[model samples]
Target: MKFNWMFLFTFLALTDLANAQFSSGNQFFIGANTTVSIHGLVLRPTFNNTVWSNKVLTRSPDAIVGEPTASIQQVHTFNEPTSFSGLVGLTYLTGNLNGNTEDDLQIAYFNPDEKYVTTTGSTVDKTIHFVSKNFTGFNNSFLRITATNANSVLPVTLVSFKALKEGEQAQLAWSTSDEINSDYFEVQRSAEGKIWNAIGKVQAAGDSKAERTYTFTDNSPANGQNLYRLKMVDFDGTYTHSKIVVLDFESNMMVSFYPNPLTEKLLIQADDWNEVKSVELVTKQGNVIPMNNSKAGSDPGSREYDFRKYPVGTYYIKVTRQDGGIRTQQVVKM
Candidate 1:
């Protein structure tokens, strides 16, 4: 499956990587047409259960089957669908420096998912850095890595990220542009914002260049607050994280009124704005005032009530949800 054009998004920075060579005491599964040379660059796979890449790049010191340029490139064929990523360390003195300045260098790459050549790379002390994007659901494919002077772009361009609470689950939806595109999206969750765990993975549109949208659901969210972010991994091993999205899950918190002691308008927001059926205001004189979203230009998701017309006193806000549940909040319009 070939794409219209490969994206070359090679932005350079600094990141220390593993050793310069495929070190000793390591294992590799070299399939047909696969070659490796020592002295620089090692592609090793992680074998952890929860964090598995589904494959490994063999690190062999006694590897003597490939040409001298094996330090700068590796060609291999996969037997099954695999997603792998690793850093390659290439020095400038080894005759592979195609450009004098660092701006003219990039890793010319190819994989089953890519179908064509897209470039990405970085450098430190003239040392070239190559990391492969995760290849998802591609098999019997040849991966080619070489050196070149070109620009790269990420296949998928994120357009937006959003979150909302539905019935009993937290649903996250995101949109992307020109996604010729990613391998998969790992949905992550956090409680205290310090620790995060992978909750689910959504398969990417490995070969699409249209406006694409994807969604994931957290069926079991905490009672109060839940944090979410997307681990967006591309086919060539490049990865990035999306902005954090928060969803509040509550049972009794039907209505929330802000600026209790306000001189302006009082804003009323609900757990699910669409679920709100009606709103009522109670005055100190036991007078009932029917309310609508009075805040000028406020979105449909919020309700604004004009409290400036009333004098300073204790007032009450009553809200009825679509499910027939009701909650009232007391406010002061000072």
Candidate 2:
């Protein structure tokens, strides 16, 4: 059954906007060149997590209608029954109506209630074409079609990345919809868009239905403004980068030492002492003195250090985790 094409366009556009708000998986494609065509449309086999939708605009039979009008067509069957399917219409317009010339078309889908599911192996197919009916006879032309699933689709919405001051370190956090075949995410920082360096990597949530959250802390962030992004990598080795988010980090942690020029012992204190993993005493000549973990319990507060064994001049106290993470401070040896 066919309805007024104008009415259908309005209805579908509104539906798409509403679906995007609540949908976890949504994707769409637009074409401009006449040679462009959509080939295959595939939906995930586990229809439980996502919803699918389609819109097609064919060249109008009557040129008086101006540009062709779009409409929502009947849902067609895909080779896989579990997945949804539908036909997209094609038509001729005022411009070139040659059999080889292509027409513009778009198809989009979203999953309002998607729960991430892992597929061992899967594939899908679709078809797109342009047809014209004139006084002479009827002619049809096919357009090249492409298929993309949840894992490959780019997110239209921008997720906010916030920076927080954690002691002397800066932490970053962001969130995204569930993904599939996701290997890991690379965190990059840039002073200018022209050059960027990988700061760290976070393992992806893999394939999931629920909203996933990720966080990364910059242990050695440069002073002033910094830019950050997630370089998402797929299991197949393919990858896509995310938009840049900028952050400004200000460090204000105070470090103080007592018993000036002390040969035997030295005391250190800092406000907001959460946990101190390890304490190290390094000499001016780059020699590391003996150090140890001084916290009494699982969580440690501020404490004093014993430096009596070594002679005094100038030295560096490097507090680090037994795992090798280091935090440094300069001190004077008496």
Candidate 3:
């Protein structure tokens, strides 16, 4: 799915306030720094999580519409099948549409009978729990939160989270606009996305209305693709996991040497010749061959050596790159 934070926020900042309670169209846009916009909806900066509801049951031309006597309804389509228990730090804010009426927001499978309800107080901030199975298929299953009346408004929102890899390290970063009774964040890692193990922990900002950024680096990330998520805990011992992100890493030492069973000379080839700083040849007995110093004298990749002077036996050719990468290959010297 395309992650357009700029588009998401820009629309959030400029949409009309009248019908802003629902999503931009019929889709629920979740994940980092994302917001939903509707015509005439004005969202306060402190109240950023918003989504426009899709069309109601009456087959209206617009994606979302309201009738004075009807209940507010909409379905949020997931880009892919999403796990119900994987959503974390989920909260919502009703737009300035419904004036003084307190509405109950309910979320569940499309069946409507099976759902969780959170009543909206005078304040617009509300939390809804998604604890069912995965929401699969193209709009077959959805994020449906029903409002008591046409004016009732609720849109789900979340904090921003990101993961990036540098060298062998994985850096995790996330930001929150507000935190309530939060305890700490446990950084979890997995070779596969299913089973997770806690690797590190970072303290949260606790209860704060101000936005805060957090970062943690995994110094010992496993080889190949590594999946990471956050286990955000509350002081009450309750916790939720952040979305999973994957980081891919490969070793830097890669090179090839020809004439393995050498009769006269040895040649080396590498992707970046400039990166190959030096080369050395040594006997299987750990004795260094002094004559191999000229192997990487000037041209590193196409470097050649006259090994005819050396007696034929098992020898190891070591290649060192400028980035501290080293690799050794064995050659039989005749």
Question: What TM-score, over all chains together, does every model reach?
Answer: 0.32, 0.34, 0.34
lDDT of 2 by residue, 156-229 (tens): 22144566767667788877653645789898885323467999999987765355778999998876445566
Best by lDDT: 1
Off by over 4 Å in 3: 1-95, 98-158, 251-334
Query: Going through the candidates in order, what is the number of backbone clashes in each?
Result: 11, 16, 14
Candidate 1's C-alpha lDDT?
Answer: 0.52
The candidate with the higher lDDT, 1 or 3, is 1
- Candidate 1 colliding pairs, count: 11
Candidate 1 root-mean-square deviation in Å: 18.5
